[model samples]
Target: MTTFTSLPPEITREILQYLPVPTLLAFGLTSKNNHSIQQHSLSSLRLGVFHSRLGGMISLMEATADRSCLHSVQMILPKSECRKKDKVIRNQNLRIANVVEKYTHTLRDLEIACWELQESAAMSLAQLKNLKRLSIRLDHPHTRFSGLDPSFWETAPGSPVWNLFTSKKGEKGKSALGRLQSLNLERAGITDYQLTKILESNPNVRELSLRKCVNLTDKIFKILAEGKVGRKLEVLHFTRCCEVEIDERVLDHIGRLLNLKELSLYGCYRLDSDLVKKLNDEQWHIEDLTLPSTPSSPNQEVQIDPEYK
Candidate 1:
């Protein structure tokens, strides 16, 4: 009598294709046979690694040491985990490093939410040469105290986090981040100069978002308006980034982003009412322009989906 495991490889591939990503992940963890089939059948597999799931994630990584099935990754740390002692956070970073290093060849999209990334894990992340999209969400006061310097670009040699933002120097000058197309950072505490370095390094990034990045000033907008990223940038968001003075000079610079399709400045209170009107009046290519309500108008700020179009 034939069994499901004994089915022909082509039949198994078809069946696995019908299953959703979550189901495939669950079934892959059930046995070696299912894992093999899942790996071969799916072009890419999604992995969600949380503090609670770290042990199981590590075990799976050990079991599939030779395989590179995980493609998209979301690593999130809970509030409780963030509040843990430094030793626990360090251990967690080590585990994250192991998992990231193991799947560098296949991992493409990564979203990390933690108090901050330690150097070890950040270095491991920089090794993902194929990474195309990245999101970093850091908690406020904790990040300030965790020795997480925002000027990663100017860090010392073997600058783990800086490596993620820059291209490796070689004959080809290939960078792990050369393929990046979208970047999002929330509460990053990065200054304009630091961010300019990042943008200059990843000129291919098409979508850029900065939320509560208090250190940014008009200088950043000036860079984008004149930098390589502006040539290709299609989406831009500046939520709660109140320091940027979006005056006529900055507005003119923004108009130079010929490819920009969407623009949002929600919660950026320093915005002048006339600038908003000017943006609306300009004959630009922007398809979506979202702005915070004026002080006279007590309404909610317009919200846009973070996902790129």
Candidate 2:
């Protein structure tokens, strides 16, 4: 009978991939060789905390740290067992942020889906300086989001996330937001000032998506179309955002962007068909556009299909 550690490297990797996350961590602790193998073998790690409690989530974070080599992770926040009670969930959110800090060096892509995103998690996200993409979405509990989150980057005065913006060169250097190329915020009620700060912090960003956001007025869109980031933005997508009418003048600036390759306004209530046609004529570089079939009528309350695009 051969011991488990006696297996070849290929065999060991295959085994680790199949084992549950907790079991894999426990196995890694058996020896240094096993630990190294776990690090190299793990590529895509997705954890579902919806089944576990706050304490269990902490244990999971510790276990993941032990295994090592986490490149991409999507953590789903645990659903409320009692619905009304969210104390445990808040704790779990903070713990998840701590886990992110542990993997900050190695992680390139991180996605967090939760009911209510706590400030701790948002702060921790700002600390990451090596990530290429950061996506946060509010799925349950809080549907209408607030951009006050990234505002932490510019506001709060003394918070860590805020400090990172003006921070001098550290282990990661002055580039506080890291190598982030894409930032997607769904249902995040980000204000004009908040979005501007986000762009200011992340100058290298090229792709951006704001979906199901309620407060995205024309001012925000105009900011993106004419701001410094506008020159570099290649993909812009806004779905089911801004119930109020958006001026054609603001959207015209977007149409003139030479770098924009993809543009989608699937469910915007403000854009009429004529204006979209004018944009198509005025813009020479837009290759992908998701516009509504017809212009929205005044006082016409109709359901616009967000998935139409």
Candidate 3:
């Protein structure tokens, strides 16, 4: 009765390391022996905790609290597109804070797609000094009521989450999350000013995405084209940012990223695809390029080409 799980633990562990999260989880549920393999592999788990199963989140967190190898977590909130009561969202945010506080030291990649962002959750994120990749997708049902005024695209004063990116008065220009290499914020209520500060803090960011952000102008792209930031960025996405007056200057700024491998400007109605075609013709080794389907059509299907000409 020789089986895969019957192999030596060392060999099993080595094989399990190559398996992705879903496969590993499935293997665990197959048999007691496989479950044992999964338990040991929790140290290097890339976990995804769904909103429907949040009641078990604490149990899962408690189980892995002692393991120093927890590397990534993706938290998806329930009813992300609909309105939720303030109290319920706050409580859920507290749970998020708990998860952040628990894995602060070991977590390197974290993604949270929720309806709202709260101060406690923001404050907890500030503690993850080792975090390398972070994605926050906030699909707020009511931006104005939540203190995110769309007209200004401003995170009001005392907003703890946005504040985390700001340098402390005495830090001599050090950013709170200085170790971030990849940062993605979708539909976030942030302005050019706050985003500039965030970019200034994380000088090593290679992948930057600001999708569907309402308040941005072309100024942010201009900053990205400058000095160290432009030189280091490998991926840049500014999709569906309707307000931005993206013209030749912004395209030129994006073109200056010498190391850029991926660029997405989908849903940018103002950007001329001919300019993108010109940039593509220049050929700077971009592996992924997504452009608007039409010159002024927001709903047009995006044209994605790895070797776009």
Off by over 4 Å in 2: 1-27, 32-48, 51-85, 140-175, 293-309
lDDT of 3 at 34: 79
**Pairs in steric clash, model 1:** none
Output the better candidate (1/3) by lDDT. Answer: 3
lDDT of 1: 0.64
User: Candidates' lDDT values, in order?
Assistant: 0.64, 0.61, 0.67
lDDT by residue for model 2 over 124-163, one digit each (tens)?
A: 6676777777666543321222322443322212223334
Model 3: CA > 4 A from native:
1-84, 140-160, 168-174, 283-285, 295-309
Candidate 1, residues 115-185: lDDT per residue as tens digits? 44667766676677677777765433222323345453222222235444554334245545566788887
Q: Please, what is the TM-score per model?
A: 0.65, 0.65, 0.65
Q: Which stretches of candidate 1 lie over 4 Å from their true place?
A: 1-92, 139-164, 167-174, 244-248, 294-309
Ranking by lDDT: 3, 1, 2
Error of 1 at 276 (Å): 1.7
Q: Which lDDT value does model 3 have at 134?
A: 80
